[model samples]
Structure formats: C-alpha cells, structure tokens
Target: MTDTAPASSPAESPRVIALVDDDRNILTTVSIALRSEGFVTRVYSDGETALKALLDNPPDLAVCDIKMPRMDGLQLLQKLRETSALPVIFLTSKDEEPDEALGLAMGADDYIAKPFSQRLLIARIRAILRRSALVRGAPEVENDEQPAEAIRRGRLEMDPLRHQVLWNGQPVSLTVTEFLILEALAARPGVIKSRNQLMDAAYSDDVFVDDRTIDSHIKRLRRKFRSVDPHFGAIETLYGAGYSYSDG
Candidate 1:
C-alpha cells in the first residue's frame, strides 16, 4: 500500500481516494495527479489487497481497474456492496461495453476506459466526491444558498442531502450519476430533458460523455427502481426527443 498526502495546506481533512490497479505505473501517476489536486490517495496493487482496507477504513471514493490478479473489480464491488455504499469508479478497457454495463448495474458510480485522460478522471473524482460529501452531510461548495430538501413525486422520494432514494417506501441504492439524473427529471415532472441536458446535470462542464452513457445510466436507474417496485414506470422515454418523469 502506498499513501500520499495532499500537496495543499491542511485547513480541513482532505478527501481520500483509493486507487486499485495491477499496473504500478497507473497507481504512481494517478496518485501524483490526485495529490497535486490536494487530494490524499491510497494505492493498492490488486482488488484482494484493496477490499479489506477499503471496508475497514473506507475512503470517500475508489477508482479501481476491472482486470486484476486475485480478485477482479467486479467481485470486489459485489462484496463491497453487501456492506457499504462507498462510491466507486471503474477503469475498463476500451470497447468493453458489457463490463461497463455490468459495473454500472452492480453499483459503480462511473467508468472511464483505459488509456484515459488524467484530467477527465480528476473531474470525475471531484464530481463523485462532491456527491459523497452531500450524502455525508458535508457543506456543498456550490449551491449553498439553495436548501437541500427531500423531493417527493408520487411513490418516488429523494433526499438530496442524505442522497437517499425510496420507491414505495423501500430504499433503492443509486450511484451518484444516477441520483443526479433522477433528481433533474423528478425535479420537474412531465418536463422532457434532452440527453445533453441530462449530461450537463450529472457531469461537470469540462467533462464530456456520449449519449449512450446517459442512456446506460437511465437504464440502470430504471432497473434499480424496478428492483424495489416491479411496476415502476415514472421515467418515460420519448422516441426522438428525450426522457421525462411523469409521477401521475
């Protein structure tokens, strides 16, 4: 295990992100990048080594590679989900849509393909950290003026502050991206939001994700809700326009 502290002054406790990968180069480079951004990091060589530490002393979030020696990222995520809701971002090989889809369905917050840009990863890290902070009751740097209120539309209830979602009174687990997308739609029931609009809502201005990413997230969101309520159909898809939420 390699741990690196933030480069910035310690005014408050810096957010901790665990990096799990078999490649030594990735661990070293990503750790340096995160440290420079004032984020403390802990790196593990494989998922087996990572799982114990991750559960014992959970980080704010984790960035894990899908392919590893002993335990794979998918197995690790499955085990982690049994006990924790810790945010996770998967690192996958390019064109591995099945793995990406599986990871999202298994509760990964997001994924970036291998040979990815460090800037994009950082942006994603910051995004997930911000959402995790909201769930942990940490003060949000953006939109502090706006109240963090619980949103209720028919059988769907979302607590932005707690980052909790309930369908028909049963709790449903959602990744940060899923939560943001759902929040945007449920915030205004019956209003259609284009793919671009949903992307803007879920990701930062600097980061770019394709339409399929949004569609995949939407699919996972519906699956999650349906897991709790078999008749869940609040989210409506318009053939060529976009998606809308209809509580009625």
Candidate 2:
C-alpha cells in the first residue's frame, strides 16, 4: 500500500507550514502559534495522511513528531528525502529524545525536546525555511574564479540545471540537499569544509542552517556515493573538523 501525508489549505498563501502529530492538542497549539506569525498552517493527525498530502503537493516546510502510529516521522522523512528538500523539525520527549549527534545521523534537521517553548519552535521553523529557500535558489552565482560549472566532479557528473546526478557512468538519485553537499565538497577537491563551512556553503553564502542539518545531509551523501562505488568515498570526515572531497 502507498503511504502519504495529509494536505490542507489554510489560505491562498505563498508560504505554508505543515504540522504532523497524533496529539490533537499539540497540533492545535502549533497551528495557532504559526498562524499568529503570519504563516498558513496545515495539520495532519498521522504519518500516512501527511505522506499523502506531501506527495500530492508538498508544503514549504514540515514539523513532525518523532513517534507515531503507522508510518512514523522517521519513515516519512526518509521518503521525503528521496525527492524533496522540504525543511523539517522534530518534536521529541525530553528523556527519550536522541542527542543532537545521534539525531543528525538519522537525518533530522532540528530536534526540540517536549518542554519546548512556542517562541523557540517558531524561531527554529523560520530559520530552516529561510535557509532552505536560499540554498535551493543558488544556481546562478556566476563565480569568476572557477569558470562556473553545473555539477562536475573528477569522475562524477551532475547537472543541477537539469536536476541530475550520476556517479561512475550511472544515474544516482539524491535529494536536493544531498546533491548540493556533494557538489560543494567536490568544488573544494582536497580542501576540508568544516561543519560551519559546509553549512554556509550548502545554505548559499551564510543564510543560516543548523549544524545538524549539514550532518544529516552528509550522512545521506555518503550512503548514495558509496552505493555507487566504495572507493567513490570522496568525502572524508576530519572527526571534529568537517569534510573534505579528495580524489585520494
């Protein structure tokens, strides 16, 4: 059976924020809070409905709870990553919540424990949207130094203009964020891009994305690249530093 996120229309608004949770109270509070901030909000009660709506027509951003019946937020996020760069944040219980380091490994952009404030939630949501928007719109930088290229690696070829990625003479499906990360690392070629550097580069000149966001994207990139070729392991983790793309 196919799974999907529910869709709702708050207004004919340009910006939309989606909230998915089994708890009616949390959904109501978040929806109201987001609306007060001048954003159109869509609320879904379960992962299946949320996934459906998202597939039919995706929202600008989504806030989902970590635990749920049926599909769960983790599965939804993985599914979403297959095609969209929609920004996402997770709501988690204080004691059960995974640490920033652990959560990033599972591909969450941001995680807020149960006792989170409305203000912090709102601010984090806004930050992700702003950064995601900026990063998603950076095809025409017109760099004078590198003669401007689409997605050219030593052996990999990607044409962001066409939204295409290939590794070792084959097509590879990567989320928009994943493709961008790989492109940035390759652009450096032997240069280490620290977590901060990766964040800045991925968000396109300092728009501001969470450090965990970069980590999540990098994890996905490694999976996709390694699937193509084990030695295609161009990305090197400098432990505390960041990442480097070396043909080495």
Candidate 3:
C-alpha cells in the first residue's frame, strides 16, 4: 500500500500590534514578550509617531502610554476617535484614579498599571482579539440557523456581526470595550446588572480594571447616546442596585 502522509496546515500570519511608549525598556520588554506569543509589534517612542503610523497603516490593536512627550496617549486617542475605531489599551505608570478613569471615558478598551505582568497583557490582548474576530465573522457561529445580525431596542440599534451601532438612524462610534458593555446591558432590557456582572461580561480577561471602570464606560455611553438624542434616557442607574437599559 502506498504511504499517504497528511499535509500539515500552514502557519497563520501573526497579528500586528502597535506599542507606543517613551520608555525604551518597556518597548523592548513588551515587544519581546509579544513576539514570543506570535504577535508582530511596531514600537514607537512617542504618541506622535504612533499616531502617524496608525493612521497610515492601522494595526490589529494598540498599546499606548498615558504620558509621553509631544502628543500624549489621551490626545492621540482623541484624534484617532475622530476617524477610526482602533482598539486601544492605555499603559498608565502613575497610580492615579483620574488618569485611568479619563482613559476609559475617552474610549480605551482597557488599561494596565506599569508594574504589570506580561501574562496579563497577553491575556487581555487575546480576549480583545477574540471578541473582535467574532464580530468580523471569523470561525463563525456553528448553528443550524444563523444568529441575528442586529439587535434593535426602540431607537438604539446594535449589529453585533458588523460591529456597528446606531442611535435614531445615525451611526454611533464606540470603542471595543464600550460596545461590549453596551451590548451586555442591552441584551436583556430592564434587567439590573451589577458592576461585577458588567465587568464579567465586558472585561472577563482584563486583570487591572475595577468597578469604577464599568461606571466610567456607562457615563461615556450616556454622553454618547444623549449627544445623538438630546432627550435620551435609555440607560438607567439604580442607586443601591446597579444599571439597567430602559428603552423608554
């Protein structure tokens, strides 16, 4: 009998990740760690260079430093928000609550403290990429019937498959974290979801985030929705309980 050996599957191309940090040590260390996990990294010393590189050639995700010389991470994120929905994870060195809150409010997917473990970073990266891939239809859902492409509740419409959101027929731009949080809340309207529950849904693999992080995302979500509908009051907060979505 002729011997038949099964051909091995080709190796998949590594995902590109942009790393923006003023510290050379971080760039080197993080890049090496990421490379070992089969991720291609493009490191930048400042936000300006990173912004230019991202606008010209976008990456699968970006890890940015909160403080940098000329064009800080917050400023760069603001600029990027004006055009693209690039997923960004802020790297904050200081243990300041405001800085972390601001970053999350400004649409960062996640944040990590400076003295963080490489394993945690890798886990967050994988979690985000998996969610994004699901939206992009990679290794699609295995079911006899296709899942609904869009979920609509009153004026708000969310298309999980397309990774798109619309309020009153107008498109609303949201970061990966924001979208995930909103999706979780909207999935079951009028149900109060505690901070812990929200965190479990949006940031299951995220290590450094806390309850305040979910609150920040909720505040930002309200601002975004209200901007579109001046009288928007969909997301309701129960003081002692948690948060719930109200179509009315």
- Go through the candidates in order and give each one's C-alpha lDDT: 0.86, 0.70, 0.81
Estimate the lDDT of model 2.
0.70
Clashing pairs in 3: none
Best by lDDT: 1
Ranking according to lDDT, highest score first? 1, 3, 2
Q: Candidate 3: minimum summed lDDT over ten consecutive residues — where?
A: 1-10
Report the lDDT tens digits of candidate 2 across residue range 65-120: 87888888888877776766566787888765454445455556666778789998
RMSD of each: 2.2, 5.4, 6.7
Candidate 3 local lDDT, 32-136, one digit each (tens): 888777788888999888888899989899999988999999999989987888888888876655888898888888888878899988898988876666555
For each candidate, give its TM-score against the true structure: 0.89, 0.75, 0.89
Rate residue 126 of model 3 by lDDT: 83
Error of model 1, residue 158, in angstroms: 1.1
